[model samples]
Target chain A: MSKEKISSQEIIDLLSAQTDFTKRQSEDFLKAMFGIIEERLIAGETVKIKNLGTFKSQWNESRKSVNVQTGEEFVIPGFRKISFTPDSELKNLVNEPYAHLEAVVLDSNHEVTEVDDEDTEELEPLNILTEQALEIKGLLSEIQGIPLTKDESKIEAEATVEIEENNTAEIPLESIIQIDPSTENLFDKIQEKMHQKSEELSSLEVVEITKDESEIENSIIEIDDNIEPELIVAANNEESKIEAEEEIKINEEIKIQENDQTETKSNYTAPEISTSSNVYEEEKIENHYTENIIENNDKDEITSIASDVNRVSEANNLIDNSLDPVDYKIKRKSKWWLILIIILLAIILGLIATYFLSSATRCWVKYELFSDENKEKTANVKNNILNIFGLGDPEIAPKPAKIEQDSVAIQAVAEDSIKVDSIPVTQSKDTIVDVFNRPRVYDEFIGTEKFGQGNTLTNISKKYYGHKDFWVYIYEANKDKIKNPDNISVGTSIRIPKIDPRLIDLGNPICLKKAKELHDLYIEKK
Target chain B: MNHKELISAISSKLSISKNEVEQMLDTTISICTDQLKEGITIGFQSFGNFEVRKKEERLSVHPATQIRTLIPPKLVVNFKQSNVLKDKLNEI
Candidate 1:
């Protein structure tokens, strides 16, 4: 996975460690790292981490980008992107170590003069209580006992806080005793006996309290401020949110009664040593070890962070060394060409389609309007065609196909023999019905049909035109006789007019087949 | 820990004269707490984040004592330590 990951370290190691480099090791390193990452990107995979960010590979699209100098458009082929984000672990380490730092002073002097630690044995009734500050810390633990943090400073502070919290809230202080009425009297008795218990507790303390009077007062007041009275309230408030008041009340009653009665030589009565002090001792030891490791780890982490930052700096430096500021700006400037090209292509395509719509309507008029059988059917088609041409005639008026035998009869009346009676479309001004009876010859070879509709004009055009696509062109030309181009009788001879040589080579005489081709080509150009 | 208690401890731990530390802790707490109070969530970059949830108001039961309880909405605290802290504490 690391091989696939874009890693400069892995690259350098491959070149400097396992693999020997003959000439430019750093260059080789770059090649190896870039090559692998590029290969993976081409394979289309995004690398992901369980608790980190994803490294995605994406490609840009090809487009008709503009040439900035000439404002001319050209194409820009797509390129790939390989991007990364810092892992959660790495990111966390990058920030400062948790603001508060605690370490065991294996090296620092006067460790004993600092925080006081308590002993665990069946000893202290009100352990280590002093002459001045022995006033607070009520009788015993409530049912939801206090958290026994090993920090003795917190414990001493906890005692001092009793005065401040009760100083005003004492108005509602009984509310707590009401919580544990059963233990209420017990606590009251314990409170009364607190001074005596302190003496007994002092005797049992494994660690002696030095008789440093001034130090005790100074530290006591400081610790008092530290011991959070509000935290206790907040904790209660937080818990009470989850616990029922009634249940809490009942439990408080039991707790108060049990401790109060215990002090009265009750059966459950025994030594009144506090258990919190012992819990604190255990925590103190744990804390010392934690501090020791934290310090050692701090050293290692500092070195690691320094190297990481150094490596990142080195990577950034390489980029600076390889590229010039001016070149970068030029490259950025060149992108406008890309933007211009994209917009231009989109617009060009839109205009082209719009242009075709205007021209394509001419095709529909040629096909649909010329096929209308009834004058009523022609109304809709005529109006549509009329909208385009203003007042011109139908390009070719609808008429019925004439049988080949009718040709001899048509020659007898050949001057005006066209079956024009069937057609009723308006003719254009200066329209010529037929100019010369001496029609030119169709140079293209003729077709022989074995199957398909016997549309006389269309089949003849396909055979002579060398393309099946022009079948509609023939239908369009002979629309005057072929009212419905879909219906036509075989062997029906039809008139074919001469066309320009570029379109069709009707050399000497324009036969019946040639005339239709000329007419179709004429309408197409128009 | 409740907001007030946690702030006090944090201040004491930093040991910046109480008043100054108190302000710092208060500002940080206020931002996160206000967001949670509004039933919104805040994302801290590395430290644990705070969010407000439905709290699941419900009827409670004590099978042993055959008691029924009607519990109301509650606000709970959740914490996730940063990897750096986890690793540092885990160092041997």
Candidate 2:
């Protein structure tokens, strides 16, 4: 940042250690410098410092751009450009003192063109030649350790003298270095393009002439019929060579078919021949030689060359620049749309998954984890198991438990509601309807019962009545035997009988001997 | 009502199937948005009323910085249940 002259290498080495670093560090530093300038410029700000110069923002006006794929135009919004100014010291350092340039322009007659006072002096070739030729020549000369006679190179020896004359001088090295690295690519492309144009122009076919339809009878000709040469002789102007050349080739082809027009009635090969010639001509124009370089050398004939061929190359090269606006706009819009759609879909899927996942998680939380009621039920079942295995407390006896039963005539029951008042053995219809869900459940009934093991009722029924559901039949048959129905007398000898009275009606299976005896008794009694 | 009668009634009305109706009901019932022009009230017969009503903005403190700021005014959907429907459902 100081005004003192210093080598760029020294400056780079001073900041952030580089002694044990790799080439990547060098790239990183350079990238950082470029990135800073680029970011600031893109944000529409100017970077300025005294002497070293100011980099100002240059915003481009919005304009139309084209899409290469579809060849469509779109609007590209205005962006920015980076501009740099070199400090006098940095300028002096970057552009080592160099030799001067001497100029002379030759006219069409090879005579020196007289200088006109009205002409801008900046167009004088001395500065341009110095910047282009002398600068490179000096650099290359220094690198190769060769001596140069160019005036610009000689000034490095006379650097002491320049310090006295100019207070703040421009060495023209600022813009030169800042021109960007890709200019070399542009230069090579330009050269390749010029060569292509030149080749295309050189390949255009010689034109031909054809006889008229009405003149087919006059087979004899007085002239050589070389109309291709007629036009070459017709206009000597090379300025009109391209147009005149194509017409002459067509005329020559026409001449070749004059005698056979009746036989070759169709359009024939004219289509391919014409197009090929056009392609040849286009290729000729595309490979235009470095016209600018030649343009500078030959200002007089340059006008004609540019008018005839360079125009075509210029158009192609402009298309190659890729500064189309509309294409970039479409790309930007689609980029946003793509991002939007991705985010939208992600959100929708997230919501659906969240709904299902939350419900499933809630179910797991309720049923699988931390359920106190379930823990109690499992504890009781575990106790029962332990008692069956004679591993539980002996004081808690393996008591045969009573089973719950409903009043036979009861109907509906609330899912969550429990009966507060017990239904009597002979309850009213309304009470039955509210107490039990169905008549089937009332077949066996009990007001209240103690909880038991899983097979307690089945085992007890088998022990006393030799039937599992006989417990229910006992409760129904002795509806008045016990008031509480749930409270049974420990010593009561209740009569237990067959459950279904209809069992007496179904005929019993016959014993063979009893069947014969019964038949003999019936016959004797008859 | 018993599941048999409920399923049968819903199935016969839809003519398609109860499963299909359940799917449609699934889509129609849950959280969703209704765009309200300047003034409008959405009425879903037994469900409820979603009314776009004027909401007044007031000053409140932002929790982060404890800064009192005035929020903007806008219309918000306010829901109110139909008493007739709510009573009928409570009875069931």
What tens digits encode model 1's per-residue C-alpha lDDT throughout B1-92?
22344334444444435454344433333433433444444443322233333343344556786454434334443333335433332332
TM-scores, all candidates, are 0.14, 0.14
Instruction: Name model 1 segments beyond 4 Å from true.
Output: A1-447, A450-463, A466-526, B1-81, B84-92
**Looking at candidate 2, what is the lDDT of residue A141?**
70
The TM-score obtained for chain B by all candidates, in the order given, is 0.57, 0.51
In model 2 chain A, the worst 10-residue window by lDDT is A205-214
Docking tier of model 1: it is incorrect
lDDT of 1 by residue, A1-526 (tens): 0112212333244334333432254333334322333334345655443223344455556778889999998888655444444345433332222213232232222232222232232123224443223443333333113332222223333322332243433323344334334333433443344334333333322111211222232223222321212122223453221122222223444434433332222121111111222223223323332432343345455455457547755654654443334234323534332333335434644454444444444543354346433233345334434422334243433221221222222222212211111111111101112222223344432333332455455456656665444454445445565555545655544544334322332332223344555556654664
User: On residues B1-92, what C-alpha lDDT tens digit does candidate 2 reach at each position?
Assistant: 22233334445543536664333322222211211222334454433354445444334566887655434334444544445433432332
